[model samples]
Target: MSTKQRIAIVTGANKGVGLAAVRQLALKYPTSPLNTGGSLLIYLAARSPERGEEAVQTLLDDAQLREAGVLVQQGGSVTVKFRELDIGSAESVAALGEFLKKEHESGVDVVINNAGIALKGFDSAIVRETIRTNYHGTLDVCTTLLPLLKPSPQSRLVNVASISGMLDAYSPAIQANFHAAVNKGSIPAVTALMEKFQHSVDADRVEEAGFVKRAYGVSKAGVIAFSKVLAEQQRQDGVVVNACCPGYVATSMTEHMDRPGAITPDEGARTLVMLALQDLDGKRGEFWREEKVVEW
Candidate 1:
């Protein structure tokens, strides 16, 4: 079985870490039980098919890595495939679920919700859009893909998150002021955190909330909470759902920053891919870094 035949889906794979994840998964199929299935069936789900195909072509044309890039398992050989998937839109998410179900009955072995947008600068619209895509869009993808995940021998769901969302990231001033509300012994505290963030954005007072990078932080915090919720929801189904901080990868998303200690897109993708195909019985609903489980 080649990678082209085994069933896997990667969202927002047109470029960056998403594309790198597709590449690494294709390269790694030979070591998996899925490899024997011939042609690992990869649905390179992206918002735009044109952009997705271009990314694929880039992989295909890369001389040094081409041989390991697009291999898919089909008829015992690997070939990569593509589909249009826009997680930010509910209709696109639903359509993708139907498309994959109709095309592959057994369900996909892995699904990576790698589509993300950053609200890096101080802008309310950017914040709203980031929340819409990073948090809501990811949930849409998970729920839509739930049925397809049920029958797999082993299924993994990986949500790409960031450390900026961690409560620790906030300054002592803000955390101290909000600790009682946020650290209360309930999910409502977390919910309140989201509400407060949204309110800040709505009121055009993101700076007051210490959210210089407003939407991105709020969205990722949602991911941390969402992952725990998903772990609880899917615990009995034998499916693993986990979130990961891919470190600061040097990609288009971070092009505006002049930062050191940033890893390559491929490096970030490897961490995500590791979570996407990790051993379910061992760790589920956990946050991971470099393939190691980390604190929520």
Candidate 2:
């Protein structure tokens, strides 16, 4: 409840990259007398409350932190509080916004839009579902929570994007729009692009239309675009919005994937943690890969 406590929310944090990122953020922001103006309180959000709390208990039980829900020691004062969140659900997101307003009077400090689902292969079985969660869901969460983030002195919004989301996924025409209006949050354009992609898929001409062949890649492209548009839209706000590609992280999502050079989830989270701690005024909107900003 102290003004010195920094609050954060990480979506889909039950396991894998999301879970790892939550742990790293907690460790990075812990309060210490030498560096303290604030202690970190991370809300590890998962689809199920039971799963969310279990993940929190895993963090506490693993002896990684010295306490739960409060600071117990320097460098270990961070606490991971579980909260149920399913970004894909409008009802769920509305409830979370209300809860944050009531629980944290000031606003949220950090928002790691890490909840994402990637469906490999070019099939209709999951194309709609992927877009529903990764694109529409992420946008919903951001739109609902932007108000809460307005109060932080240096708030940060890091969207978990992917290398596969490179602009080349789209045609020159589509890519030009994204690059031309670099500082505008074109939510309508993004929505239109999503619709176009779906249409291409429905017509079975996705590849012919200059969009990514797979649903996963296109969805991530939406995320990368969202970060840019959001950062551009909120140019006056005291916050940073950046997209990070954690490489091919070794998680369940990628277990069946035959990709090379995949790193552990914890290793993948380091850059995300670094981004979260950056001065909000320093980097307004950037797409990053392996700790360095890359062209999107």
Local error of candidate 2 at 294, Å?
A: 0.8
Predict model 1's lDDT versus the native. Answer: 0.73
Worst 10 residues of 2 by lDDT: 66-75
- In order of appearance, the predictions have TM-scores of 0.84, 0.91
Model 2 TM-score relative to the real fold: 0.91
lDDT of each residue in 1-296, candidate 2, tens digit only: 88777778989899988899887776666442212566678899989888888888787765554544333443455777888899989999999999999999988888888898876567665888899999899989988888888544367788898898888757898787656545455777777787888898889888787777778877888788878888876667766788899889878888735567878889888778777875433676788888888877
- lDDT at residue 285 of model 2 (Cα atoms): 75
* Local accuracy of candidate 1 as per-residue lDDT tens digits, 1-296: 22235578888898888999888887776676555545566778888878988987876665535544444221224456778988888999999888878877766778888898875575667767887788888878987887788544367888888877776666565555344543342345555666677778788776677654557877887777767677667767777788888888888888735577888888889888777654445677677777777764
Clashing pairs in 2: none
RMSD in order of candidates: 3.9, 2.8
CA lDDT scores, all candidates in order: 0.73, 0.78
Measured by TM-score, the strongest candidate is: 2
- Write down the TM-score for model 1: 0.84
